[model samples]
Target: MSFLSALRRPPAAVRLNASYRATPCRSVSTSIPAASDKPAKASATATHTISSCTEGTVLGGLNWLKGQAPVTALADEEYPPWLWKLLDPKVIPDDGPGGQGEKVRLRKENRKKIRDVQFMKTQ
Candidate 1:
């Protein structure tokens, strides 16, 4: 079957994604204060920001609880081995280096070739 035919719904039965979990009802008294209620001072904001900002983004797996995720402290261990090549590039780059040098080099080369090209109309 083609791509559209493959995606077409079955006439017999329709499958639905039932991945939702039953959330516990919390008491109104336990709720945190509104953003406006928090202190407007820079120091207060900075401290909160530092605490909230969990370094080394969650990749490869599901992060159900972002605050208390199973993410390792050392990013080098958790992250893909090739990611380092992009972060800290080598002389002769390995796969997925995605180096800025290559783009710059290509752009420069293209401009030079364009300048050198002689059109019959211009001549």
Candidate 2:
């Protein structure tokens, strides 16, 4: 038989379910409160600011339930004057002898080279 003629034929037998249990209905309270009677407020009071420690560094996170805002990171392109002053060694004291200096020096040395792969091919 041709493809079009085969498609027009109906299949053998079809089974159908006549009954099924539907979902249970939820009952709601019909009692209504008076306009003058206010709803009870939250039981426990929240702290606006809470001090916390992270890896020996002191930091603060906000408690939004008390209506305080959280601190955010400064954008990569934006450099504040106070931040520049902070970066200067004379202002912020360096950690003793062999700590952060080596990592900072390595990063500075690596940054001096051209990063693009196209530049690497020329050399």
- The Cα error of candidate 2 at residue 9, in Å, is 78
Measured against the true structure, the TM-scores of the candidates, in listed sequence, are: 0.20, 0.20
Q: 41-120 in candidate 2: lDDT tens per residue?
A: 33434322211222222112212355556433333234343532332345434576665766666666777554555578
In the order shown, what is each candidate's alpha-carbon RMSD? Answer: 16.7, 27.8
Clashing pairs in 2: none
Distance from true position, residue 94, model 2, in Å? 5.8
Q: Candidate 1: which stretches are off by over 4 Å?
A: 1-74, 89-108, 113-123
Assess the local accuracy of residue 94 in candidate 2 as a C-alpha lDDT between 0 and 100.
57
